[model samples]
Target: MQVRNRQRLTLPGCSSSGGSSGGSSGGSSSSDNTLAAVGMTKNQFRCVFNPSTNRDVLGRANTAAMIDKHWTQFTSAASQLNFRFGNLDEAAVFFGMVRHEYGGYLDDMRENCARQGVACRQYDTCRQGGNNYYGRGPLQISHCYNYEAMSQYVGVNLRSNPNALLDANNNLGWRASIAFWTRPEFNCQGTWEAVRAFPTCPAAARAGNIAAVSQRINGKVECNQNPRPANQDNRVSWIQNVRTSCFGLPRLTSNLYC
Candidate 1:
């Protein structure tokens, strides 16, 4: 019900594509300048794009060229947020936490759209209001109702411009994601308490607490079973890689989830 002017969607914590891929004034170096233009620091840029990992979430080898080629688009989208992450920890934890899942979701949605002719029938929400709402954006937003709500929140009129979510240049992809994250109603628990302040300064940033945070984002505990959920495992791995390899942070030793 509440739309427009929501705390500027400020995030004290929480926290990117190849080439111009689309919407860029220059090449890789130009892409780097864009981040600075948007007020993102060099360290913040590295945490988001150059994770210093061997392989990305899709299992492709991670390389500087790959970063040069793809991260520009991702950074473009993520930079739409008006707020800045407080530190490297906040930025790395958030970027790592979401990169795999959202990146995977975008791929899946594109495949579904290709096969289903612009609409995915598997999700009932996609059929609402006769809008053929397929999952789009980093968070893979589906459901016509949700689309309309997001349009209002982002001031993009997504109900009519739903495909804009797929347009990295428009920055709608990340906009929809941040909107969903800050809103408590989007989660099954009616609040994303996991992202709030905890006994520690960065409670959710700790790897042990990743499962709890994932559960909040996923609305369920995914990695607790004998065979961990593929999505859950991917996200956990992403966090681990970013923390150790990219940020050079200590390993999260707690086994919060088996």
Candidate 2:
């Protein structure tokens, strides 16, 4: 059986959110300014994130106010980790990954833990707790180890309450996703490093590489495969679409595949 780690990308209609254009600003002090710097307006964000068919994910609507609230929290979390969105390219890649992973649904779940085989060993505590920690949140952060780590990083007891990652009221899902994006853990730091260094780093690693970011997110299952996994292609395509359609970029940077 194929182990589905990420959801298939389905591009939605999106329009550019005009704003400033430049490299990273080291870090932004204001979430509103950061959003503008990254060229993400309420409509663009909603176009890419809000599901067209559903009233909302679970019971929470991805409303403009909710999106603003989440974006604020996301910026705060990135700042806490000494990271920043920097530019439109970085924002495209980040949101692209989120689109591929969660498909804009907050209640999306990845069940069937036993199929993970040896990977399930590290999350024994979550299994014993009678809660399957397969995947949750915007990035679909899986495993008990990740939950414990994120709990420590966010000062939340996710180990005891993994469901909190899906709670829109507390805005833990977006916070956990941003924390995962900033920290280096999943064997690929390109996602974090690319965005983090956009301001000062050289051109080679400056704009961010979607391929490297995808590798970091799920290289074990999708990268370096014989058939060029459809999910991988979908990820790249979705990100590129976000770049051109959402942010009005001509094309992606470099290294677009893993």
Candidate 3:
């Protein structure tokens, strides 16, 4: 499943910095990189600057290539959303969701729509010369209620034409994700909040189950207040689970939980 990297506990020149670490992993390419696997269900491997050659570790071989092709879009969208959120926990959660939503392919969603007969029908009398049926955009913001909101927000007349899902330039790729970040329909219906900074999240910083702690943090802020999935994705790893990830403490300068 996940092809992991060779483990070496000793980090390079890692001094007792307050929160940052100095360890490095060796990899010729990004695809060949190793991820911190089998622990935090959330992909928690430290990012390496080299090109990736490690495919299995990231659940796909061409991940680096794909990200490279699309990272600009991702980063740009993330930049806007982060400004709104003002929190790193939120940022990481968005990262995970983006990876999950379209396999990072803003265009791949077209395939999903094609499968659902979105491009194949005719209509008369309903509105917009009939409508398509595929799920729309990165957030799967299906149905009229959701789409209408997005259309209004975007100032587009999607109510009439309805073929806007495939456009890569518009905000649907990223904006829609943020719009639905914690809607009741998603896996946790919880907007992924950034992990509290060290000291702010000491228990979580030291613990193994990072996901649970992150959950606790968002839960405190009502980001995760909706109904959860039946068999949920494990929120975090053992170390991440050990600490409380709540962002409500004082000195917390985060953008979320406001």
Candidate 4:
């Protein structure tokens, strides 16, 4: 195991699912910022709250039971990843997102969060999808309307019962998987192959290459259609930023030392 000088844990391609992850901020004072199970002491905002190390917390032995219970509509690994991304964040963000999005207050809250999130260029904001609004699911899908639109494709009332997103099978950790394989940008040809590039420029180029792949799928040039220039703050760039934040690594091809 190679220990990074900065104690950075870079996650590329391969996926691991434990109970959850823990994060804490350094030199700051906030009750929510405390680190719990990660076995490391660091000051940084955590995406997942204090993770449970108890063997039962992850409950892998009962995953099939989890599915059979209908806790989640997803039967495939891809669908499960899609359910995890957004929910994988901190509890506050998770509560704020799911509570407003798919909970009792869904219809309006989804719009509210999306409007605030997307326009503000923040996650959980109202997003613009082709015909429906996707909002912040996995890959931060902007327009949730796509959920309802795509429901028929998956044969689930994905848009109904907002609280459904909170279900363990759904919320436990499926969102990330969905985004990895399905997003238009993610599906672009040779896209997955370039994810391991070390620095930003090449990383952005790889992202661009994927966007080009997307163009073929989209057939029309659009703003989120290509990768943004180096250091440029745009959709694809921001998406990479999120990935970087999660994995504790830089997406830049230059390996720009932070």
Better of 1 and 2 by TM-score: 2
For residues 71-110, write the lDDT of model 3, one tens digit per residue. Answer: 3444454455452432434333433323333322334443
Per-candidate TM vs. native? 0.60, 0.70, 0.42, 0.32
Worst 10 residues of 1 by lDDT: 1-10
Clashes of 3: 37
Cα displacement (Å) at residue 89, model 1 = 2.8
Give per-residue CA lDDT, model 4, range 1-258, as digits (tens): 000011011222211122122222212244323333321112222221112110111121222232232222322433433333222222122222221122122112123234343332222222442233333332223324444444543445555532333334343123432332344343222244433222222232333232332232222323232463221222233334333443343444431111
Lowest summed lDDT across 10 adjacent residues in model 2 is found at: 19-28
Give the whole-model CA lDDT for all candidates, comma-separated: 0.47, 0.57, 0.33, 0.28
| Cα distance off (Å), candidate 1, residue 27 | 8.7
Order of candidate numbers by TM-score, starting with the best: 2, 1, 3, 4
Top-scoring candidate (lDDT): 2
The candidate that wins on TM-score is 2
Q: Candidate 4: deviation at residue 151, Å?
A: 2.7
Local distance difference test, candidate 2? 0.57
- What's the best-to-worst order under lDDT? 2, 1, 3, 4
